[model samples]
Target: MECLTSFCETHLQPHQIAPALKRHKLINPVKNLEDRMCKKHKKPLELFCRTEQMCVCQVCTVTDHKGHHTVPLKKEFGEKKAELGRTKNQMQQMIQKCLQKVKEIKHSAELSNRDAEREREESEQVFTTLVRSMQRSQAEVSKMIGEKQKATMRQAESLIKELEQEITELQRRCSELDQLSHTKDHLHLLQSSPSLCPPTSTKDWPDVSITQNESKWNVQKDISQLDKKVRRALSELEEKLNNVLEKSKGDDLKRMQQYAVDVTMDPDTAHPLIIVSGNGKLVRTGHLEQNHFYNLKRFRSRVAVLAKEGFSSGRFYYEVQVKGKTGWNVGVAKESINRKIGGLYPEQGFWTVWLSFQVDYEACTDPHTPLSLKSKPEKLGVFVDYEEGQVSFYDVDTRSHIFSFTGCTFTEKLYPYLNPFDDYDGSNSAPMIITPVNQTP
Candidate 1:
């Protein structure tokens, strides 16, 4: 068989002409016409196998595709073209979703840049203040040293003048006595001897050396006083830095609150001993395990519960009140974590900060790092940036940062976690309450 390209009416189709018209062949304006022929049967495929959703020849329909619903290939082509239109619509929707995600990423980057700039400015302010303080202290100590040196020089000059005058008087007395002895004048000699014998008219020349040691002692005393001033200045500087840090924390708290979300306890994932409040705002441990229906989501051991809400992307912040609770754990846990024996480690799908023994605190990590906080936080703030892989904890009462888990890789949805830590002793009996954040003014 041969093919030719021409207008449909002008070209003589080979199938229509006899073998004598070997110069002419059918011209198909549509591309890939050969693909319409069945390879095995060497025949034009005219039917479609609805079961296989593929074009087939009539021979294929009665043989390989027996009992399968078949339709005209031309009809199937129309349906497939319409189906492609629907697929194109679906692609548009997927494209729009990706565009939305791109916008979100860009917005987050912008926010991160803004925060970095603020941090830089604040750091410059603190270092500038520290440098100025040191310079002022240095100037004051230098002035004291210079003034002391001048005073010492003046005292030495005054003592030297007095001693020089006494030497002149003694020399004059000796010359007069020599003159009197030569002139044989007993009265003059006696008068000069009495004056000379009186050890000159100098005022008590005993230990008349200007004591450099005394001046040194005065400088030392000034230095000691300067030390006290430096200590006081340093203490003031510490207070000032603390004030700055506290104000920054307050500002950050307000910012974090902008992402604040309302959270409630979920009883399904809670331990058997845990009790979720009616309002779902609080959770506590009961002395005895409650009789409940069997649930795979429930925590059978640890006295912990997950919030009803879960986040897979972006940022979220929430606060919890642990005022009366002596021991508690608060943070986020990845979905699909072990419910039977929940472990508070990132490896175990938990990123958390916990308090134990009333005062000790730790950020749950692979090794669980210890944290020493200055003030006991009656209220705690938890913030998570899923894309950035950061989970931070704050002391709401003191407006201070307690700990942060950084460099994490989260691939699943995260749920807010809370545990009241059911201690055998009645000390940790307080319920962990989800509270509204009080943003500092």
Candidate 2:
């Protein structure tokens, strides 16, 4: 029993000793706890994490970074967030500016397009208006030209027809002459037969031959006269036709304008005077006041006639006032003189102004002829002058020059003669007044 108890004690007790030895070799839990506590409570890494763009462990910070400022992870994250916010704001502003610029460009383009469209429309309108106006003018001109052409063609056709008719008449006359020649030959053969012969008949034959010859001479004379008349007619027709052709070819007809004037003559009454003719006949004379009393007469003529001898070639105007004491004849006279009259007249022309009084009319070759002044003529006078190259005749009613010549004179006519006073006073006639057209001074 004692041995068994010893064995059990030794084995069990040995296990117990091992346990105690293990306990003795183990580290101290309190120390390890203290170490972990130090690690947790110690300062963080003092490194410039933001500057380095990296995070460092506490051990690395303590080893590598001495006396350097360090930042917390949260603080770094806050800075990055603030930077990102600023960048985002700037980007937004840039995007807005870009959008605004794009919008402005679009608006400008639209305005430019509108302006171009308007200009194009205006150009098209102007072109269309011009074309329409040109077309209208062209149509008018074409119509006028067509009418003129047709008229000319019709006239030509008429002339051709007349010529053809004349040719046909001449052919007919030639045929008739041929037939008459044949008939005369047959009659001569019959007359030669002896059965047709008689002594009394022979005398009658001679008389008949004389009558035939006379008839033939009359026919020849008639033919000559007809020929002359036909030639004259042909010449006149040719001349007229040529004139028409010339007028058609020239533009003179299109460029003609007419101007007219009128003239009146009157005698002066204030100053009385007398005139003695070469035949010892007394012509009536009277005193004539200036621009007061005168006779009046009217005459008519064309502008061309005035241009031939008058001064004013272009269109002109005039007015006249006349005062007279006695009645006198006033009319136009052709520039023709009776050889029996001594008056030497100008070439054959027309004078729109003339005055004639009773005169001892004796036909003479003298250029100056004095006719009797009849009908209680107190004064007889005429005034003539040219102004602005225009020739005018005036009759003095008063001594004043209030006279105008509106009539044309193709030839100089009997100049009006005025006697201011009779031989009782022996004074001159009243002074005449004259003025130029379009003249102020």
Candidate 3:
């Protein structure tokens, strides 16, 4: 069959209006006008098999499609056309919904990108300020040490000058006495002896010495202290950064608590002066050193212990109670940490914080970083993300953060480390207790 427009263009001749009546009739031609015959029987497919859903001739209904539900081809065609119209409408609605979803996803992605960029900028700024502060602290410490050395040297130089002057005066007096002794005249010699009974000195020199030890200062000790000050400054900056990030989002305690695990002390790794309870949860310093079986892994100096459980990957959290304790150290340490030389810092695979005299709170960085908290905490929560290399501390009582050590590259398994500082007159006798985690509401 030929399309109407093509037929009109070829037969109607140029400049002809083309008959509208024929065009309109062709557009709405009756359905089933064309005879579609099945080749098997060469018969027109005038009937439809509803069960088979295919066009069929009358003979097919009686033979191949025998006993099957059948309807007129035109009637079935009308129903199917109506069904197609409904399907088209549903397809259009689905397409519209998918387009809206695409828009929403794009908007969310844009917001996420913006947040990431802003956070990146903020982190850069914070680190820059921290570096500057550390540099200034280093300069100040160096200047102070240099000035002390100069002052001591100046004092020594002034004493040397006064001693030289006394020696010169004594030498002059000896020379005159020698010249008088050599004189031929006895009267002259006697007069000289009377004058030189003793060279009159302004002051008596009795046991005067400028010992170097008295003027010497422990440069390493001074530098270590100054390093602590610098670390404290850095810690504060980091705390502020963490707070800002947390505030922009929400508290991370709940998320961290999800990884909470029970921690117990390992007696084998403990110092002889340290005692771990049978349950492994409690640890305290002993007044008298216990003669336990000799162990190579035992702490040699500081009274500290390591937990039985060690983590190599993923996150973990634990809680400890330090109530009534005057001094204590609690945190995590790498498995390979030198237990023999127990009092270690982060650089030496020990990441910890300590309380001294129940007043001073500090983190054991290379140079101990002092923490200034709003209030002392009896119960503390520790969180560690091994892969992320983050160790954080929280004051569980106030639900406030204490400090966090980040940007570490962990290779070995890390275990919880604890230290019950030496008991001095029983003032620091309280145990560093590891307690069960009671999730905060």
CA-only RMSD, every prediction: 6.4, 43.3, 18.3
TM-score of 2: 0.30
Can you write out model 1's per-residue Cα lDDT over 180-280, one digit (the tens) per residue? Answer: 66867677666666555555353677756666788788878887887788788778778877776777777677677768888988888888899899999
lDDT by candidate, in order shown = 0.82, 0.37, 0.79
Relative to the unseen true structure, what is the C-alpha lDDT of residue 369 in candidate 1, on a scale of 0 to 100? 92
Instruction: Estimate candidate 2's alpha-carbon lDDT, on a 0 to 1 scale.
Output: 0.37
Model 2 lowest lDDT segment of ten: 299-308
lDDT order, best first, reads 1, 3, 2
Deviation from native of the Cα of residue 321 in model 1, angstroms? 5.6
Error of 1 at 427 (Å): 7.7
Q: Comparing candidate 2 with candidate 3, which one achieves the higher TM-score? A: 3
Q: lDDT tens string, model 3, 107-138?
A: 65675577667767887888888989888878
Better of 1 and 3 by TM-score: 1
- TM-score of every model? 0.67, 0.30, 0.46
Q: Largest lDDT belongs to which candidate? A: 1
Please report, as a residue range, the 10-residue window in candidate 3 with the lowest summed lDDT: 21-30
Q: Sort by TM-score, best first: what order?
A: 1, 3, 2
